[model samples]
Target: MPGPSPHLPSGPRTLPGEGRTAVVTGASSGIGAATATRLAAEGFDVVLGARRLDRLTTLADSIGARALPLDVTDEASVAAFTGALDRVDVLVNNAGGAFDARPVAEADLDSWARTYEVNVLGTVRLTAALLPALRASGAGDVLFVGSTAGLVSYEGGASYTAAKHGVHTLAETLRLELVGEPVRVIEIAPGMVRTDEFSLNRLGSAEAADAVYRGVREPLVAEDVADCIAWALTRPHHVNVDLLVVRPRAQAAQHKVHRE
Candidate 1:
């Protein structure tokens, strides 16, 4: 969906990720896709996994990364993806998104279920499956692409906020539990990112999507968050960036945004 990526390092990326293997979920588009491409370009043997095999394959081909079909909500799918991988030096859990923007009183149970499945349970499944390989790596990195919604809630965001809060807690608890392990757990919470499909998918209308970023001078792009993810991983093994919150300059917080 993106134009030719100039961000990728030039030349043939022959094992550019070196021997380090990285797996990214929801990599068919947006943040996940960008993160997979960024990681691959950074010399990490990246595996692009998502439910959409066609798009995954396309991106994989473009970046010379492996493409695998993955649905984080399904245990079998996650198992199959992780089973196919022998080593996982880095795992980017980016498979989740907001479903609806309604108050709790009007929330749809089904939508909430879907949100939790992809955001919380899905992360649990994938991370659990890959923990062994990560531990073996002695410097494994696990990154979660969370959202500002995870940290603060707003009106018409009941289900999404709750789900992301679960993700934030999951990252915190996992880090403490893995204190002695070699694996590092990191969470990147981005705000007001205008991806091709994120707002459109959430609002289900071109006009609604446009309104989400209306009057904003500049919003965070997928590459901005990908840059953060790639940077955190490349750091010395000793440093574990517990949480990194990123927002567009116009967005001071979930409740505060500077609209022109």
Candidate 2:
């Protein structure tokens, strides 16, 4: 899969955003934080939303963006979140994460449920809430920061993989349904990104997270993925990036990660 663009020609098209509003979920850390900053620099009025208010405030302050407390899994919270926004042109769904790496047979039901709620249900809620505004904007974009896990299954990644697969399909279905509509649905699936908390939260230890990237060549970072998001949104309104799969060279595939 391709990661970043080598060079992109500036098309003679209307930029999706030129003085527009963008809502970024999971802005508390990692890819979310990186994307929030990126969009802001791209001349967007960025709103940062996440459960962690303190972190959100910090990021918002640094980037001159608004921060909102949001829990995408809760319908009420999502309602309040969308209600607060007067206008939204772009919505970046970056709030999901992996809970555990257990096989299907030994899966922890709670972990799986949590994964689905946040990864799939949360995205559905937010996207539904913002659809009306997006359609009205005439150049709206819905971008999902998915994972390489969505494309291929692995031994101990059933739950995450399944949830991402749902996300992948959701993007596909939404795009097909929205044809000729003003809005566009795009999905960015990345592999083997080394963030501060991703591997640590999944594998449960500073040591374990360290080991995941130890002896590997440079892995993709949160900012790298953010770069992709910014680039896609800048394209002409008619150019919809259907699905982009990005993986670090070391991570050839989900099950074929190169450790050394």
Each prediction's TM-score against the native?
0.93, 0.93
Q: Report how far off residue 34 is in candidate 2 (Å).
A: 0.1
Question: Which residue pairs show backbone clashes in model 2?
Answer: none
> Clash number for every model?
3, 0
Model 2, residue 183: C-alpha shift (Å): 0.6
lDDT of 2 by residue, 128-210 (tens): 88999999988899999998888888888888999999999999989998998999898999998989999888889999889
78, model 2: CA deviation in Å?
A: 0.6
Question: Candidate 1 on 1-260: residue-level lDDT in tens?
Answer: 86668876867756435779999999999999999989988888889899999999999999999999999988899888888998889999999988788788898999999989889999999999899999999889888888889999899988889999999999999999999889999999999999999878778898999999999989999999999999888888889999999999998888788999
Q: Over the full model, what C-alpha lDDT does candidate 2 score relative to the true structure? A: 0.91
Model 1 alpha-carbon drift over 4 Å, by segment? 1-17
Q: What is the lDDT of residue 41 in candidate 1?
A: 85
Q: What is the RMSD, in Å, between candidate 1 and the native fold over all Cα?
A: 6.6
